[model samples]
Target chain A: MTKPAFIAVDWGTSSFRLWLIGEDGNILAERRSGEGMTTAAQAGFANILQAHLDAISAPLDLPVIVCGMAGARQGWVEAGYIDTPTSLAAILTGAVVVPGQSRDVRILPGLAQRAKDAPDVMRGEETQLLGAIAADAKGEQIVCMPGTHSKWVRVVDGRVTGFSTFMTGELFDVITKHSILSHAVAGAADMPADTTAFEAALKAAFEKPQLVTNLMFTARSGQLLHGTTAAGAQALISGTLIGAEIAGALSSAGQGAAITLVASGRLQTLYEEAFRSLSLPYQTIDADAAVRRGLSAAAEAIWLKNESKS
Target chain B: MTKPAFIAVDWGTSSFRLWLIGEDGNILAERRSGEGMTTAAQAGFANILQAHLDAISAPLDLPVIVCGMAGARQGWVEAGYIDTPTSLAAILTGAVVVPGQSRDVRILPGLAQRAKDAPDVMRGEETQLLGAIAADAKGEQIVCMPGTHSKWVRVVDGRVTGFSTFMTGELFDVITKHSILSHAVAGAADMPADTTAFEAALKAAFEKPQLVTNLMFTARSGQLLHGTTAAGAQALISGTLIGAEIAGALSSAGQGAAITLVASGRLQTLYEEAFRSLSLPYQTIDADAAVRRGLSAAAEAIWLKNESKS
Candidate 1:
């Protein structure tokens, strides 16, 4: 068995994932939990990390590299942000070292676009970008990372030019839970997704992105007038949001820009289906793999190569 | 004072407004309360309506005309709907008489567009439309009624063509109260609105309606990057929603269609500003007066004129 060399952690707002990398550059062990920054902020970030390290029986002196909300102001440590238009490699140099730790710990900084009109910031996803694209890649590339707050980033010749965050997933959650659409989506979770309703809504919203809110109202109106099922309503809401997001994201892209979709599981299936339905071409990248590779790059740049040189 | 002729009630989801109309068509007495459909459903609709009637010293035999949510399926009575592509007078004839009442009480029916692609329904707003536009008015007319659920109706040659309901106001409310943007607008209510931010957001959204959710994220990113105030964030959210709504509403409007804005109070000011910012020509009408006039028309059609004729 390959000996564990370092730890890679993606500590988000509500989720935590840890991977122990061996000397041979392979995942020796992995752990996932709900002990993200929010939970760890209350439970103690050090204690949580220590417990996971203890469970994995990792080397006491092993260096740990972390990314995501753990570096946010309210998280474990403020790793700060690297302003655009910056090369993806700038993220490696912006890692903030944890103070007074027995084992070396570093957290990657986020990316901030300071444009007055389109001000935007993203944490964790920057690392995913690092792994998803090659440093020497050519042409304009649009990377879509779908999640609670879906991000659409524009990269020109390996440097991130700009990006926009669409509140798709979070909006879906709130609209179906707190808004009038809640009644329309009740009993939807227990049912299978209605693909036909989803694709139709996706096409409609993509064509008339301005009518997003009106399209959302159709979730209830359709149920009332067309007798659409709860599952259909849920699919409509999801598709409308995603469809509008895709339209907005692609609006600023350069003509013939390649699309790289970084997602996994349900989100993967949904976005791939949306791309097909809309006839938009895109390449897929495993989100977990991308983030892990990003952490690996940061790890080697910060510690591994430096240790060998010393 | 002229003798009281009839009672007009506009019972909405969360508000109740009643006006005692005299024989001369002037308001003799008025009562406003929070006993709208939701509250009335729990506290007894008939009892609530009778209490308001008693407060105004209304005669027992005096007839009543109702509009708004009170005519919904879950309200006082199911007043049903007048399908679209019909004369505005159809709404007047579709009034449903409430049974088991000593006094003659009728609830005006709503308007429903049964288009499979864009099914929509409007209760009180239809009555507002009845008063805002003349039945025999020629050409195309677009009515903008901004509220919790903003409604936009397209009318032509005295017939109601189609309408759409945008969940703009409701989306703003939920996004600000329940989503991440909630933190961006924490203390906005106590502060004056930021018109600069509002106008900028309005134009941005109007130009790129598809980028709405992405623009919404600027409410937070602006604060983080530019130190934008809570008021500014709130204004941005409002402007984005309203701007997108206007863009969507106008997308389907016919060329040379006159815009009739039916709104009052804060909504009136906001929408008026939105229209002016976009340089969109619109004539304003008092929403209260419009709904009242509509209720009066319904009363005259159902009982007042009929009583004299009999």
Candidate 2:
């Protein structure tokens, strides 16, 4: 068995994932839990990491490389941010080392766009972008990483020109759970996916992105007037948000730019369906794989190569 | 004191307002309460209406003209809807008489636009529109009724053409109360209004309505990165929603059409500021007065003349 070389952690706001990478650059074991920054902050980040490592029976001195919200101001450590326009490789140099740790621990910094009119910031997604896009990739590309805060990134010749964060997923959660539409989508979770309703709503919102908020009302009004199903209403909300996001993202994107969607599971299927329904071409990249690859790149750049040199 | 002629009530989802009108068309007495349709439905709509009537010492035989959600399916009586492309005067003919009441109680029907692409229904706003626009008025007019569900009605030559409902107010409420932006807008209600932030967000959203959801994220990101005040974040959310609403509302409006804003108090001030910031010329009408006028019109049409004839 290949000996574990280092641990890679993606500690987000509400989720934690750790991969035990071997010397042969393969994942020997992995651990996933709800011990993200939010939980870890309360439970102790060190204790949580130690418990996960202990569960995997990892070597005590295994060096750890981390990404995501764990490096945020409120996270395990303040790794800070590298402001755009910056090359993807620049993220490697911005890693903040955890002082006083027995083993080597480094957290990757986030990316910030300081444009006054369109001020934006992203954490963890930078590493995903690094792994999703090749260092020497040519031309402009729009990479969509859909989640709680879906990010649309514009990469030009391996450098991130800019990006926008659409509060699509979070808004959907709040609106469906807390807004009046909550009644419209009751029992929607137990229903089957309404692809037809989703595609229709997607097309409508994409065509008239301005009418998004208005379109959302249809989830309820449609149910009242036309007897649209709970699943249909849920799909309508999801599609409308995703559709508007895609439209807004592409509005600022250069013409003929390639679309690469970095997502997995349900989000991947939904976005792929949305793109297909709208006849927009896109390539898919598994989000987990992308983040893993990104953390691997950071690990190799920061520690592995140095050991070889020594 | 002049003799009480009738009672006019605006029964909404969460509010109830009744005005005792005199023979000379003046308000003889008024009562307001939180026992709207929701409460009335549970507490007995007839009993609630009777209690309010008894408090005002209203004539036992005094007829009642009701509008808003009282006419909804779940309210006192199911006052159905009048399909659109109809005249504003047509709403008066659609009043549904409540059965088994000692006094004549009639609930006005709402307006429904059954356009498959943009299906919409308004119970209370139709009455507001009835009082805001005259029956014989000429030219195209856009009526903006800002509230929990802001309605933008397009009236062409005194006939109700179509309308759209933007979830602006409700979205603002939920996003601020339930989303990540909640922290950014904490204590904003006590802070002074941020007109500068409001205007900037308004203009940004109006220019790019598609980017509204993205712009909403700025409420949090701006606070974190730019040290924006809580009031500024609150203003940003308000401006973004209202701006997108106005943009969407006007997108379907005819060229050279005038905007008639029907709102009162805080909503009026906020919407007026939004319109002024965007430099959109608009005329204002008191929402309370408009609804009262509409209920008066309904009373005059349904019972006043009938009593004299009897």
Candidate 3:
């Protein structure tokens, strides 16, 4: 059996995932929980990690590699950020070590674009980008990483030129829960998703994204005027937001740059439908696999490869 | 003392304002309260309105004319809607009287655009439109009634064309209060308004309104990357929403239609600033005066003018 090499973890603001990798890059064990940075900050990151590691009975000496909000300022140890226009390789080298750990533990830094006109930052998606796009790949590429704060990164050759963060997911959450439209979409979760409303709204918003807020109001108005289903209202809101995101993401991107979407589950389904509705050709990479691969690459560079060389 | 001709009230979703108008069209008495439709729905609209009427020491027989959410389906009385492409005169004739009221109390109907592709409805603002624009106003005119849900109406040759509703204000409220960026704007209300930041964000979003969600994220990223103040984050979010609203409202409007703004207090100030920043010429009408005038017009058509004719 291949010996355990290192543990790769994705610790986001509200979620935690850990994987024990073998020497050959095979996953030996896995664990996921809600004890992300927020919970860990209160319960102690070290104790949570130990409990997860103990559940899998992993080697005590195995080092751990982490990314995402675990490295945020209010996170575990403030892993900091690597400013753009920097190479994906810079992310691997900027990992900050957690001092006095029983085993070697490091958190990958995020990327920040400090442009006055269009400032943006990403904590975990940089690693996903690091793995999603090949380091030596040529030509311009637009990589879309969708989540609570969906990020659209512009990659020129191997370097990350810049990126923009669209508050699509969080906006959807708040608007549907807190706005008057909340009443329109109250029973949506129990109903089947409305792809018809989704596609139409996606097309309209993609064509005239400035009218997005106006379009959102239609969710309520549509219900009142035409008895639109609660599910339709929910889908309409989602499509309008995602449609605007896609339009904004490509607004300044080089024409014909390949669109690579990195998302998982529901977001993946929605974005794919949006791309198809807009007739934009695109490719997809599973977000979980990409992040694990990115973390694996970082682990090899930080520990496994170094151990072999020595 | 001039005899009270009628009681004009603008009873909105969350606020109530009443004015006792004299026979010669002057204000004889006034009252304001938080007992809007929401509260009055539970406390009883008749009781609340009568209490205000009694407090002003007006004669018990003075009839009341109301326009706003009080006319909504969920409001005190379902006064219903006058579909678009009808004359503004139709609204004056559409008032529904409260059946069991001690004196004449009529609620003005809202406007509804039942277009399948762009459905919209507005309750209070049609009355504002009736007051803001002259009956024989020639050429195309665009009226903006800014509030929780801002309404932009199009009128051509004194006929009501169509309108769009943008959820800009509610979005600002929810986003700043519930989203992740809420942390970025926690103390913004205590800080001085950041007009500089507001203008910069306004121009950016106005120029590329599709990038609104992305621009909104900058509120948080700006603080993380450049130490932008809480007030600046608040202003940035506000600017982005308003900027997108303006762009959406005019995307298909006829070029150079006279812009009339009917808004009061803070919204009026902010919208005026936005128009100035965009170099769009516009004239302002006090929202209070417009609504009051509107109610008065409905009263004259319903009772006063009819009384004189008799």
Candidate 4:
């Protein structure tokens, strides 16, 4: 029986995530904090890490692997991203080793893809794709990870081929909060299970794709004339946003790409319903389950990689 | 002949404007400054007003009639707006008089519709619209005034029937600065003459009208796939923004209510082309001309109202 040898971190804009795992891929403990990259930007990285690290009374020598914004320009270490159409294997295999004062910490570099056909940059998803392939181990798999920036990652033979990112969450915030659509949305309400608006909007999206801008006036106009409330307006906005997301994801991956959507909560149902309606074959995986699983797997791989050298 | 008994001020978010007119409606002098409401917010209203007045060597004893945010709760004085379908006869007739030290200052109220129906509000436009109506005096007409918050004013029989405001400028800023669409947009390029992209986007807007949200994703997808650079992307963003503005204006005014577009400089061609393509009849009045006429008209109304009292 081996003690936990390493921790994996998924540091995002709003939250800091930690996963502890043994050499034999098993989760030992986990921690989280509001001290994410954004907060850490204000509170300095060293203090945040020290405060968060206090959660574990272990040897400070434990090797740790960090992902996400923790590797970007403002993150803990600036591990530059590699460009698009990159593989997880390439990322994990090529991840820059970030040395911490008290421990051996490795921060992964995000990919920056600029090609004739595709131009995009991605970070953090590469490690997860590596872990997902390590777990799924099937043939070519397209992983659709949804968040502020939704990524459609292509993995072939445990290697990341390429991926595209849509600034879905950011756009959702802008359109809903600032655009004419704000009049349409209220505070978050439970999405209708059937997602009637989502389906209609998606259908509308594919049919008359240009309505994106024109339909905006209706958010306010409907209320002005037709007496549409803000809540109903919000639904229409959500539907429109999801519709755009679906159209972009479908076009990026193209038809026949079996999409395994790693999602949960409200977005899960919306994406599930939207993908199902598109006649696209997809499997809905609990995002949280995959998150820890992916984290632990990366930890185990890193531990082994270091162990072999030792 | 009443030498201009007062100066009328139309202060907005980005620009400060003032006009001095004789009792006979002759434009005596006019002044312009970048120190508008938002900028003025930092400088303290008294300083902004005094500085501008100081620049023109305007008489402190001359009373000033002001419209727009300068009268909001955050402004120099909270001159409350009158409800509409209410007329300028009512607003002008119902103007609130603020007694200042040396000179009497009055800030005219903007028009507020059901905050729910359109959540639209306007300030300077009420005075400007009155001027447009004063210029024509044919009584009731629709004045389409375009700015960050585009207004379509209902002038019924020499009085303001009602008006609605749309957040076009703010929407343009958010889309270009924050939204995924920003990837495609140029940094504040002047609207090209008969900008093909702008025209096409406007057509796309009115074409489906309902699927507007779906269309936004293409701003990113287009750039990603077809090498749509920032300028072309910006054109699309502008197209979408203006298209939405046009849609909002059209919807508020309903189909074909005679409209006189109050604008000048760069906005003239865009508005003229948009209205023409939509088959919505409109005539353009120079922006400065309208502002001058509006200031003169407001002054005349104030003088008349005061004389009636005296």
- The DockQ-derived docking category for candidate 3 is high
After superposition of all CA atoms, the RMSD between model 2 and the true structure is: 1.7
Model 4 over residues A1-310: C-alpha lDDT tens digits? 6587677788877888887766566767778888888898888876776666677764588877787888877687888766555545556555567665588777777776555324566667666565555644657777888877778777666656666665667767887877646645654455433355457656654443334433344455555445665665665555555665666556555666678888879788778877777677888777766766655555556567556421
User: Which regions of candidate 4 are displaced past 4 Å?
Assistant: A13-16, A31-64, A70-119, A126-288, A296-310, B13-15, B33-63, B82-90, B100-105, B115-117, B131-168, B171-261, B264-284, B302-310
Cα distance off (Å), candidate 3, residue A123:
0.3
Error of 1 at A102 (Å): 1.6
Model 2 agreement with the true structure over A139-210: per-residue lDDT tens digits: 889999999999999999999999999999999999999998999999999999999999999988888888
Interface RMSD of each: 0.5, 0.7, 0.5, 6.8
Candidate 2, position B276, lDDT? 87
CA-based DockQ, model 2: 0.83
CA lDDT of A256 in candidate 2? 75
DockQ values, each candidate? 0.92, 0.83, 0.94, 0.11
Task: Give per-residue CA lDDT, model 3, range B81-159, as digits (tens).
Answer: 9999888979988899999988989999999999999999999899988888888988899899988999999999888
* Model 1 per-residue lDDT tens digits across residues A150-232: 99999999999999999999999999999989999999999999999999999999999999999999998888778999999
Question: How high is each candidate's TM-score?
Answer: 0.98, 0.97, 0.98, 0.62
Best by DockQ: 3
Q: What lDDT is reached at residue A129 by model 4?
A: 61
Local error of candidate 1 at residue B185 (angstroms) = 0.3
Give fnat for candidate 3: 0.96
TM-score of chain B of each: 0.97, 0.97, 0.98, 0.86
Error of 1 at A304 (Å): 0.9
